[model samples]
Target: MAALTVLALAVVAFFAYQANAAPDRPGAGGKPDPTPVEEIVPDKPSETDGADDENPALPPDSGDGVRVVYSLSAQRLWLVAEAPDGLGEEVLHTYPAHRSTVDPEPGAYQVTRRDEAIPGSDGVPIQHVVVFHSDDEGIVFGFSAAVDGSLPDPSAQARTGGIRQSPEDSPQLWEFAEVGTPVIVVP
Candidate 1:
């Protein structure tokens, strides 16, 4: 009995030491030590970029908040985030992309999975895959970039749901679209 009691006390003491050794963080039963986050102000869009009705600031109806807005018609994608000040949202990056073979119907979806590198449906090496949706036919839809920086062949009869982005741009999208992050598809 004494041996068992000593063992129980040792276990409790070890946990107490671990708890004291843990780093202090905000909302972790410690005083909030808020860290200031410096916001990166991406170059503001040119006034004329949306001066024409052809391209009005962001898609006409992309919902506000931290989300990835994909426009099927414009063949563009925008990574948006809540401003550091919480005043509103900011478009961290935007770039042109090739449309996926199977479009997730115009609606809201969330990033479901991701792959750092894999062979795309077209048998080409792709990286930074950020998958968000899948169609009824079991085709998975996601954003990726060809390692060789090649865009999908417009004439290829391949049936793939991979939206190809520029090699320079795919990494940014992959970093921004984490699992459960909202993805808004706008027509």
Candidate 2:
């Protein structure tokens, strides 16, 4: 019985030693692995070749609310309105923006409830509770009904003048007169 006990202790000690042995690769699970530094990192350029020079000029009908224009071939959000002459169009505002990550399918506009926290100039908290998108820029521009009543006569000037960026930090226009409705964009 003493001899059997001694053999059992020897087997346990051998297994423990084997279990505690260092792996061939450091910081790995008992396996040989190549150094991380030896792995190649892929290179990605933001702009594609000839993307800029190939950009088409803004179309004649490109007047804004939520128009999508290309900057150096990168898609940009544009806010435009009719020119004062009652003849042509003019660009009002532009912003660089990232499209919605989850549902960015083209040509579909949906008004959804959003409750994002934003910081005010005085460090107060503001929330963006409403968001809308339209395939037509005009529709997006028309949704700013909250600001239409506060402007002076000759409302187009008011729409064009003193325009401020959206509190939501979005490229989309936040305020405008009712006359400035119907955001139009060229394809």
Candidate 3:
């Protein structure tokens, strides 16, 4: 009887923590809206909107050139396209990504490979997988999304490495980010 009471209290505490930890979004488990409505990931470079202009994702000194900036803290992805003159750059698009509890170290990385529909670590059929960061063992963290746009929410104890995105946004990433493209993860 005492153990059951303790477990019930723990569950209540966990729910309270989740309500505070995650920023409220309409599609996220029915939480209250935390920010204004905007396009988190644009379709193209020229067609991008100014929804993410104020909150830049790339860190200063991240350098110029064609690269993708991913912020782990902000859960945002910004595609950068450099100017032909080699002096200026522009943000192609911005996206809100869902990452696993296992985070990759913030550093420069290059895309190593690409593949089609496959079973991700979370046991979901994922497509548009652009492999970038992998540990010495077998963990690989890359850009991918479930074939049906369903997201897998794992607990902290689970060491998942797949970076989930939307079905609508996955194609954009697949078309824009080719093999060997630069990817910089920021805090």
Candidate 4:
């Protein structure tokens, strides 16, 4: 019992040390730090280049310069990466996508989870799943593609929260999006 108590205290002390010892941040005293506001640098641009401009949605709508955009009204998705110099955004991929019969609200969401293959709520085999939103009823709004490239045809009574993509698009989405990646939905 004494050993267990010591171990617990050690764990608490480690956490407390971490909380108090952030390397680059201003100390608790809030003194002026060495790194000035003007000297701060923006994030470096992504390395990938734009995909073929032949896509109909070549010029994707800017969700305020965010990387990924899902248009509920158009049923389309655009995958963008920042240009190497931060001068602009490059359209990495754009394709026709399908949304749930009940669309999610227009807003920004982050990729909360991913799965390589899983049976959807409607019992369809899906792949490249990246979930971003969910409703109170446990219905999730996510991107997936039917493994066989079949367009989603949920029964009329089936209220699915799946936003499906083409089989071709699924792999790309899986590779690009990870946990915390921004997924902006627009009406």
After superposing candidate 1 on the true structure, give the runs of residues whose Cα lies further than 4 Å from its correct spot: 1-41, 47-56
Give the worst 10-residue stretch by lDDT in candidate 4: 36-45
What tens digits encode model 2's per-residue C-alpha lDDT throughout 61-114?
Answer: 444443433232234445445555767544444443322212222332334323
Ranking by lDDT: 1, 3, 4, 2
74 Cα displacement, candidate 1 (Å): 0.5
1-187: candidate 3 lDDT, tens digit per residue: 9999999999999998787676653446554332221323333322353343444545566656888888887887777776446687666667778997677888899889898778888788999888898987667889898997877675756687788888766766777687889999887
Q: Give the Å shift of residue 153 in candidate 1.
A: 2.6
TM-scores for all candidates: the values are: 0.72, 0.31, 0.67, 0.66
Clashing pairs in 2: 64-80, 137-183, 138-182, 138-183
Whole-model Cα lDDT of every candidate shown, in order = 0.80, 0.34, 0.75, 0.74
In candidate 1, what are the lDDT values of residues 53-162, reduced to their tens digit?
33336786889899999998888888888876999877777878897456667899999999989999888999989999988888888899999987776566876788
Instruction: Between candidates 2 and 4, name the one with more favorable lDDT.
Output: 4
Worst 10-residue lDDT window for candidate 1 reads: 32-41
- What is candidate 1's TM-score against the reference? 0.72
Pairs that collide, model 1? none
Q: Residue pairs in steric clash, candidate 3?
A: none
Query: What is the per-residue lDDT of model 4 for residues 1-187, given as tens digits with 9 covering 90 to 100?
Result: 9999999999999999887776665654555433332232333333454333334343334465545688877788877676657897566667789765678888889899999899976678998899998989777999999887766664557888898898766777787788888988877
Estimate the TM-score for candidate 3.
0.67
